[model samples]
Target: MAAREILADFPAGGPRGSWPAEEKAAELTRQGQPATVRMDLASDRFLVVPVGERS
Candidate 1:
C-alpha cells in the first residue's frame, strides 16, 4: 500500500479527547488541504493525514 503524508500528530493521552486532532484536520480542510484523523495504535497518537489515507 502507498504511504500517506502525515500532516500532524497529537498525543492520544490528551485530556480533551481527540478534539485537537479533529480541529487540526478541520482547519487543514478549510485551508484547502482536506484532512482527516486516524489512530496510530502502535504510536499511541492521533495522526492528521490526507483524506482516504490508510495505514
Candidate 2:
C-alpha cells in the first residue's frame, strides 16, 4: 500500500477533541477531495490525510 500524506495536524484532547481535524477534513471533502481524520495517541495530536487517487 502507498503512504498517505498528512494534510493537517492539531493537538488532540483539545477543547473539542478531534472536531477541529474533522472540520478540516470536511472542507477537503466538500472540495471533492476525499479525506479522513485520525488521532495519534502517542503524539497526542490529530491528523488529516487525503484519500483515493492523487492528482
Candidate 3:
C-alpha cells in the first residue's frame, strides 16, 4: 500500500474529496501521531487518521 507523511497542515476531521485512506494512516504514524486505518468504499482506498500523539 502507498504511504505519506502526516503533515501538520493536514485538514482536521476526516478527509475531504479524493484523499487516500491507507496513506493517511501511515503518515500519521510516521509523524509520531496515533492513527487508525480507514477504508473509503467510495474510492476503494484506505486512509488513516491520527488518534493521538506519539507521546
Candidate 4:
C-alpha cells in the first residue's frame, strides 16, 4: 500500500490540542478510511494522515 499523506497539522495548546486531529481521524474512520496521528520530528506538532483502508 502507498504511504499515507498528511492531511493537516495541529499545534498543542489550550484549544488546538490533539483533539482536532483525533476528531478528524475518527471522522475518516467512520467513512471506512483509516487515519492516524503522528508527531513531527521535533515532537512538537501533531499530524493527521489518511492510511487508506483499515485492513
Question: Candidate 4 clashing pairs?
Answer: none
User: Looking at model 1, how many pairs of residues clash?
Assistant: 0
Scanning candidate 2 in windows of ten residues, the lowest lDDT window is 46-55
lDDT (C-alpha) at residue 28 in model 3? 63
Q: Candidate 3 lDDT, tens digit per residue, 1-55?
A: 5554333332234546644455666666787876765444555544454564221
Task: Write one digit per residue (lDDT tens) for candidate 2, span 5-40.
Answer: 889988876784448898999999999988888776
Q: How high is each candidate's TM-score?
A: 0.86, 0.73, 0.37, 0.62
Worst 10 residues of 3 by lDDT: 4-13
lDDT for predicted candidate 4 compared with the true structure: 0.71
Highest TM-score among the candidates is held by which one?
Answer: 1
Which stretches in model 3 have alpha-carbon errors above 4 Å? 1-31, 52-55
Q: Evaluate model 2: give its lDDT.
A: 0.79
**CA error at residue 8 for candidate 2, angstroms:** 0.4
Instruction: Give the runs in model 4 whose Cα sits over 4 Å from its true position.
Output: 1-4, 14-18, 52-55
Residues 1-55, candidate 1, lDDT per residue (tens digit)?
6677999999999884448999999999999999999999999999999998877
Query: Which wins on TM-score, candidate 1 or candidate 4?
Result: 1
* Model 3, residue pairs in steric clash: 21-46, 21-47, 22-46, 22-47, 25-48, 34-51
Name every residue pair that clashes in candidate 2.
none
Q: Alpha-carbon error at 47 in model 3, in Å?
A: 0.4
